[model samples]
Every structure is written in C-alpha cells, then in structure tokens.
Target chain A: MRTAEALRMAVEALRVNRLRSMLTMLGVIIGVLSVVILVAIGTGAKNAVEKEIAGLGSNIILVVPGQVGLGAAPTQSRLDLSDVAYVRRVVGDPSKVTVAVNSGEPVRVGRVEVFATLTGTDENMPHVFDRPLRRGRYLTGTDVDTRRRVVILGSEVAAKLFGDVDPIGRQVTIAGVRFRVIGVYETVGSTFGVARDQEVHLPVTTAQRLIGLPRINGIAVGASGPDEIEPLRQRVVAALAARYPDETFSAVTQTQLLGTIGTVLGMLTGVLAAIAGISLLVGGVGVSNIMLVSVRERTKEIGLRKALGARGRDILGQFLIEAVLLTTIGGVIGILTGVGGALLIQAVSPVPASITWWSIVLAFGVSAAVGVFFGVAPARRAARLDPVVALRTD
Target chain B: MSHDERAGRRDDERAEASAEPGAAGAPAFEAIGLTRSYRLDGGVQVDALRGADLRIGQGEFAAIVGPSGSGKSTLMHLLGCLDRPTSGTLLVNGVDVATLDDARLADLRNRTIGFVFQSFHLLPRTSALDNVALPLVYRGAPRAVRRERARAALEAVGLGHRLTHRPSQMSGGEQQRVAIARALVGDPRVLLADEPTGNLDSRNGEEVMGLLERLNEGGVAVVLVTHDADVAARARRQIRVRDGRIERDT
Candidate 1:
C-alpha cells in the first residue's frame, strides 16, 4: 500500500480511541520534557560558573601549596613572605605579585561583631587582584614596613560593622588588637557560594605576627598578557620547586581552572540527560503495549485486508507507521513543553536554565527511535498473522 | 519483460492451449484432488478438504451450498487464494497456485479476485467510499483514481448517495451493498462471497442475491456460499458439499 494511505488509515484508527492515544503519548511527553529541562538547567549552571571565572580578571594565575589530582593528599605549605619576594624578583616586578593568607576572624565595632574572611596582602592588591578601594587607601608599603595595625574592610563587612557610620578611620578590634579601618573595597559579588564581599584585609607582616603563622597559604600573580600568564606560572613553580624541593606546588592558569570545571559540568549535564532518557524508554514500552493490543483487537480487520489482497509488508508498514506517528507527535509536544518549562524556571527562580540546540535534537531523535524500536515487534506480529486464523477470530 | 508481463504472456499461452476448438478461453479456477488438513492442539489432525476436484469458469453465477463443517468455506477460501491447498494442483487464471510465492499470490488475488464475508466486513469506522477504495489501495492506485472507481462501484450497487456513510450508521442491506461495492470496485474476474446474505432478513437477502445476479450478468463471475436451498436455487449452478467433499453438482 502507499504510504499516504497507510498514514490515513493509522490516523483513522487512532482517532477511534482518541483518549487512549493521548494517554499513551503522555509517557513520551514527560520523558522528553524532563530531559530537555534538566539538561538546560545543567548547561545554564556551567555557563554561569564559566562567566564568573572569566570575570575574575585576566592574565591571572594561582599557585597553591599542593599537588592536586590523582587522589593525593595536599601537603602543608611552608611558603612565606620571602618566597613572595623571590617570585617578584623572578618576574622583575614587585608590584605584579602578591601572597594571601586567609583565616576567618571576628571583628568587633562597639558591641557589633561580624565573622569575616581576613586576607593579608601587600600594596599591589589593587593591581594584581583587580580590587580598588571605594574609600580611603589600600595598605601602603610604609604600612607593611612598619607592621602597622591598619585594616581594610570588604563592602559587606563594612556595612555590617559600621552601618550608616563611615567605617574608614574608625577603630575595629581583631584578636584583641585595636586596628584602624583604612579602606573599604568595592563590592565584588559572590561565586560558587563564597561571598567575596565579606572579607577584611591587613598587611601580611601584621597578619603573620597576629596569627603566629609565618607561612603564606597561596600566591597570586598577574601577568602582562594572556600569553605570559602560563609562562609566568611555570617560572614561579620552577623557582619555588628549586627553593623548597620537599614542597609540591600546584600552579594553574585561570583558563585551565575554567576548563576543568567545564568538563565536570558537561558530564553532569550528560548524566542528567541519561537519567531522563529512562522515562522515554518506559514511554516506548507503553507504545509497544498499546500497539500489541491494537493489533490483537484488529485481527479481523487484518484478515479482511489480507483477503482483499494486502501483502504482509503492507500490514507491517501500516502498524509501524502508526507507532512512529504516535511517538513523533509526543516528542514534538515534549520539546515545546520542555522549552516552556526551562524558560519558566529561568524567569521565576535563581536556578539557571539554558536550552542547548543539541539537547533538543537529541530528545527528538530519541523519541522517534523509541517508536521504531518498540514498534517492530508488534508490527511483525500483525504481519505474521495467518489470514485464515485471524478471520476466524470473529 | 517484467514478471507481471511474463505471467500475463504465460496465461495467454495456457488459455490458448486449454481452449477446445470453440470453447470460451481458460477457466477462472481449475482444481484437481485439492486437499487441506489442519492439526489441532495436541496433534489431532482434521482434514478440512479431502481430495476435492472442481472447475469454475468466468462470468458464471455459482453457489456452494452446505451445512457447517462441510468444507465449502475452505473451498471458497482456496479459490480466493486466501488459503493454499495442502495437496493436488489448483490453477487460478491459468497460473498454478503452488508455483507462486506469498507475494505473487497476493498480487494475483489483487488483480483478479474479490471477497465478501457474511458479516459485511466493511471497515467499521471508515466511510463507504473509503472502504470500497481499500482494495485499490493495495493495488497502489492513486487517490483520485481509487475514489472515482469506488464511486462508480457504489453507484452500481445502488449506494452512490450513501458514499460518506459509515457501516455502523447503515442497515444490514445497505452495509451488504457497501461490501458488494468494495468487492466490485477492483473489477475482479471472480467474486467469492461467504454467506453473503446470512445476517440479513428475507427482503435484504433477496436484494443482495439480485445484486449478485445482476453483477454476474454483467460478465463478472459471482460465487456465493449459502446453506439456504431457496438462495442456492437462484444461481445458474449449484454445488452441494458434505463431509469435506462435493456430494452433488447440478
């Protein structure tokens, strides 16, 4: 039989049981919807993280005191202020490099107390970290030379400690020592759940003296250009390796960090897509079950058609086309629903959702495949039925 | 040449050879010792047809009259090419059925035969026109051509006005006419009908028999299966079957 006639016949058959057809299509609809929405959300989150990483200033490199990856335990860093100076000498620019020692500390202003991350660094903080003070001045070289008990408050810390009161030139206590808040850095929004606006900065020498720890946790270097970032990192790692042969340093460029995070997020998206695909499989089974029932119910019809001179392949084509038509329609509905759901989630919630073109294509392809895969057995069953037996079935 | 053209040529040669001086060409069906047996559950075999021989020619109105389990229906089925004989030779349109594969048999049936069942066998949800057009669909006829032929057939059966009506919406007589239209739409050389009027009242039965007689007079062979002697008496030929064998032919 011709394809057009077969399709028309299938449409007529399905129309006879409209409610049953719609109900059977529900499985595939939900399956494709979940796959599209879940993959969109995963892709959206990955994009958000990637954007944040890119915004953390260009030509930047991080040097941490650990040999990460391969399930190895991170070693404690013995890197100190001199190593920072050594890196500066290797780069031939003192202002282009800095060291950060992070520790959580409680700051007191009158009776108000706020827990904040305390970072100790040098005068090059603005240049290296892209951090500019909103008021007052950053810690100068004179402050570090004299080990002055001066401090800089992050925007959030400044607001929390001295709300409606100018925090600059005000006294705050840290670890029982009186310090003057010299500056308040401009707001830098949070990323990966770490609030960058809840920090307090002081001189590296003063933090070492106050915390009783002379070792720096990590080093931050700013290169002249993107091309120089990797070379600068290699030189730093080599110089550090030469000085402390027993210590392992993990040097990474910002791009490298972004790439690793991107890979992890991509896998996460793939896993979510796979989990959602199970529903599609179940939907296909529903299609198969319904097709088998339809074939059985139409045994007399099959016999009549065969008696009218329809070939076995004609019967098979009719049923198979019906099955595929059912799934493809469901798949289209699902794609529309998923796109709407993703858009709704993106608009209504903080959870990000980005619909990738490939996900749409994949979802549609799989739904159609579900039809063909599940359709074959029932179509074959219909084709293989003997006209004599089928006609006798009443 | 294509297989169909070659088959047609062979058919012509066989018809020329079988014609006896001034006889009307080849017979529509020729069976010799035809037999069909079925194995029931647990291997109990039943012979549906026990070595029966028959011959039917084109444009002849014939009736096979028998009671239930008499194998008249089996003979009709074999004649329609819906079932194959287990033994012996059966030729349809001058081609040995045993030599044809399933597809070839289907093609032959499509080109040369039509069937009508007792229950009307019209597609329940389809319009009369589409149901009549169904046989042509398997023939790969275009939509316009199928509709035109189906309309002509329905008009011939006195159902041209009810073209769009479904089987469920029509009465038994009208539905039977629709089945007749479907069977006649293909312009088959032979029409095999199993108890064509079994489900209808006397008036409707008379109407169906009259339609079949008219179709046969128009040079389309009509073969009807019935148990009623009154119905069988209307045919030009009567074939009585009993116990899987032909008991009488008049």
Candidate 2:
C-alpha cells in the first residue's frame, strides 16, 4: 500500500484505542518532561555564572593578610600599603595593581544614620573593580597623600542618609572627624547577595587617621588582562614572600570563587538526564508491550488483511508507524510542559531555567527513536503471523 | 441490477480476458497432484491434502463438499494461495503460483482472487465502506478511486444503503454481503468462499448463496467449500473429498 494510506490507517487504528495509546505514551512524556526541566535549569545557571564572570574578569584578585587557623579570622589590614610597591616591583607593572584598606562603622549625617561597610581605597579603585562614580570626583592621589577628609557613599548609603538629595559637599562624621562627601558609587547591587550597595568609601590615609585604622588592610591586584592573571599571581606571591619572610597569605581569583556552583548544576543535569533516559526506556518497553497486546487483540483482523492481499512488510509498517506517531505526540506534549514548568520556576524562585529549540528537537528525536527501537520485535511478530492461524485466533 | 453495473462487471471481465495469456480455454485455477503435510506436537505427521487434482473455469460455480476432516478446507487454502503445497504445483489465473515468491503470490491473490470466510471476517468498529475497500487498499489504489469501486461493489451485493454501518450493527447475512463486497472490490477473476453461509439461518443462508450465484453469473468464477448438501446442490458442479483426496467430481 502507499505510505500515506498506511500512515492514515495507523492513525485510525491508534485513535480507535485512544486511552491505551495515551497510557503507552506516558513513559515517553515523563522522560521528555524531566529532560527539559533539568537541562533548562542546568544551562540557565551556567549562563548566569558566565554573565557574572564577564562583569568581573579573571584579572581581579584579592590578597588577604595571614592565613588564620581555627575560629580566628585574619584581618585584611595586616597586608600593608607598602606591599603595593612590593607587588609592582616583582610583577614589574605598577598600573596593573590596585591596593586598598578598609574599616566599617555607623557614621552620623546630622542625626540620619545607617550602618554601612566603610572602605578605604585610592584613585585606581574606580578602574580596578570596575565601579563607576554616579557624580562628582573619586578619591584622587592628592587626596590620599594629603590625608584630606573626603568620603564617597554607595548608592544605598546615599539614599539612606540624604534621601535623594545631592550629598556632595555635605559632611558625615566618623569617630568625630568630619569628611565631605565627594562621590557616590553607581548602583552595582551585590555579588551573590553580599550588600556592596551599602558601603562608604574614603581615602586610605584619612580612614587610617580618622577611623583609627592606621594601616592598609588588603591589596587588590589586577593583571594586565584576564589572560595574565595566573602568571601575575605567581610573581606577586613570590614578592610578598620576599617581603614578609615568615607570615603566610592567601590569594584568590574570580574563576575559583564562582566555578563550584556551575559544576554542581551541570553534574546534576547530567545525572537527572540519565535517570530520565531510563524512564524513557521503560516507556519504550510499555509501547512494545501494548503493541504486542494490540497485535494479539487484532489477530483475526491481521489475518483478514493478509487474506485481502496485505504483505508482511505492510503489516510491519502499520504497527511501527503507529508506535512512532504516538511517541511523537508525547514528545510534543513534553516540550510544552517543560517550557511552561521552566517559566513557572523562573517566576517563583531563584533557580534559573532556560529552554532551547535544539533541546526540544533532541527530545522529540530521542522519543521517536525509542519508539521504533522497541517497536521492532512486536511489529516483526505481527508480520510473521500465520494467516491461517491468525484467522483462527478469534 | 442496473445496466451500468452489468456493463462495469462486463468491462472488467473483458479486460481480464484480454490481459490473461492463453486464457480462452484455460482453467481460472488448477491444482495437479497437490499434497500438504505437517508434523503434530509429538512429531506425528498428518496429511491435509494428498495428491488432489482439480480445475475451475471462468464463471464456473464449483463446490467442494466433504465431512469435517475430509481436507476440503486444505484444498480451498491451496487454491486461494493462502498456503503452499508440499510436493505439487498449483496454477492460479494461468500462472504457476507454487513457484512464485511470497510477495508476488500476495499480489496475485490481491488482483486475481477474492476470499469470503465462514466467519465473515469484517474488521469490527470500522464502517462497511472501509471493510469493502480493504482489498483495493492493499492494491494501493487512490482513496477516491477505491471508495468509488468499493461503493459500486457494495451496491452490486445489494448492501448499497449500509455503507456506513459497522459490522457489529449488521445482521449475519449483511455482514457476509459486506465480506463478499470486499472480495469483489478488486474484480478478481475467481472467488474462493469457505462456508460463506454456514453461520446464518436458512433464510439468510439462502440469501448469501443467491448473492454468490449472482456474482458467478456476472462472469467471475466461484469456488465454495461446504459440507451442507443443500448448499452444495446450488453449484453447477460439485467435488466430494474423502481420506485426503477427491472421492468424486460430478
């Protein structure tokens, strides 16, 4: 028979047993659904991490003072401002280094107060950490050298103390020393939910003199570019060892800080996909089982068709097409469900999920392939049925 | 029947007559020294048909009558190309069917012969139109053409108004008529029916027998298998079998 006619017949036959066909397709449905949900989440989280890493390149590194043991935490100030030159000397690149000191205490601005993290950084702070100023001037080299009293507020801190008014030239007191507000950092929010938007930045020496933080706490080192991070880190570490001679320190890069989340999500997606594949296998077996039962139920019908001039190949084509058609329908349902489920997740929670067209195509392809693979034996059995005996079946 | 219906049947007969080589006097189907045997569960062998010789001509209504185990069904099977002979050859529509492969034999059966079983094996839950058009479906005919032909065949069998009726909704005689329509939709040269009226009451059985007679009268050969004396008497010729071979042919 013509293939079009055979396909129509297969569809009609499946429609005659709609409930059974749907039950048989359930396994494929669940398999495709899980694959979509898990893979979408995996790809979405990976993209989110990559976007974060793009905003901050691999060249950004943080150096902490001494490695503290037990419950004691080593303060970043133990790494002094002198280490900036030491780093520039050994790395042979002064422009590629950014050094900073820090302290945090609630400072009053005419009775309006907010508990804010206070940072002491210099001219290169804006460029090194990629934080841009919303208005006015940043801390200049002259400001740090003269120990001038100037401070910059984060967007959140400015909004809290000044309430939308311009804060430049206004004074906020810290430990009884008045400093004029020079600039506010642009709204960069937070990294992984740490509140960077509530910080107050001051000149390194001013913070030392006013806040009683006498020396630099930490040095942030920048490579020439992202590609130079590892080599620069090695040279800086050797320089630090040469200077301190006995104290141990810690250096961390952007990649090491964010890779773990992506790794865990990726492994989770892979493991879940394998489990879904096993469920799909079970669904395939369900299709095979139902097809075998259909063959048995329609034995006399098969015999009649055979006697009416249908060949073995014709019978085989009928059953195989029926199996594939049902599974493809299941696959389409699965794609829609996965997309909807992902959108629902993105709406309610922080877990990321993304569905792509290629994944849909692959899921459909796998389900259809499973249908055919499992459908072979049953179809073959039906095709090889004895016309005489099949007619005698019912 | 309408004149157009008679003309259509005659046109098919004329077409078949011209297509078949040396078909003027040749039997529509023939079997010479045919034998079929198979082993039982315990390796005991049984012969269903042994060296049975038969010939059927165009437009001949021939009946084979025998007791329950007399091998008449085996003879019908061999003649219809549903099974092969073990040691002898059978010719169908002037071709040696035994020498042909499985696919060609299927094609020959599709185009050259139609079968009506004792049980009227119409597919349940399908319309009579679909059931009747099944043979043409096997022939891969276009949908409209197959439907038209099947409709004509159903009308010829006097079931024109029952086109959409499913088999379960039809009476025994009507279902048998639908089966006969399915058989004739391909316009095969021979009709092989196994106890076509066996399951119906006397009234319906006679009606089905009359339908077969009319089809045979329309220039298609008919071969009927039955043990009923009255059913066998309707045919112009009868072959009686006993002990795996023909006991008499008259």
Give the top-scoring candidate (lDDT). Answer: 1
Judge candidate 1 against the unseen true structure and give its global Cα lDDT, from 0 to 1.
Answer: 0.89
DockQ for candidate 1, C-alpha atoms: 0.68
In order, what lDDT does every prediction score?
0.89, 0.83
Per-residue CA lDDT of model 1 for A278-307, tens digit only, reads: 999999999999999999999999988888
Best by TM-score: 1
User: Residues A1-394, candidate 2, lDDT per residue (tens digit)?
Assistant: 7788888988898889989988888888988888888788878877776666556534787776776333557654556667776776776656656666666689789998788888888877765677778987888889989988899999999999999799999999877778899988788756654467888888887777766656777777777787888877677777787778887776767766657556766787778777877887888889899999999999988888888899999999998988888788888888889889988998898987878676778888999998799888889999998787788676
- Listed for every candidate in order, the interface RMSD values in angstroms are 0.9, 0.8
Q: After superposition, how far is residue A345 of candidate 2 from its true place, in Å?
A: 1.2
Candidate 2, residue A103: Cα displacement in angstroms equals 11
CA displacement after TM-score superposition, residue A378 of candidate 2 (Å): 1.3
What's each prediction's clash count? 0, 2
lDDT of 1 by residue, B111-162 (tens): 6788888998888878999999998888777777789999999999999899
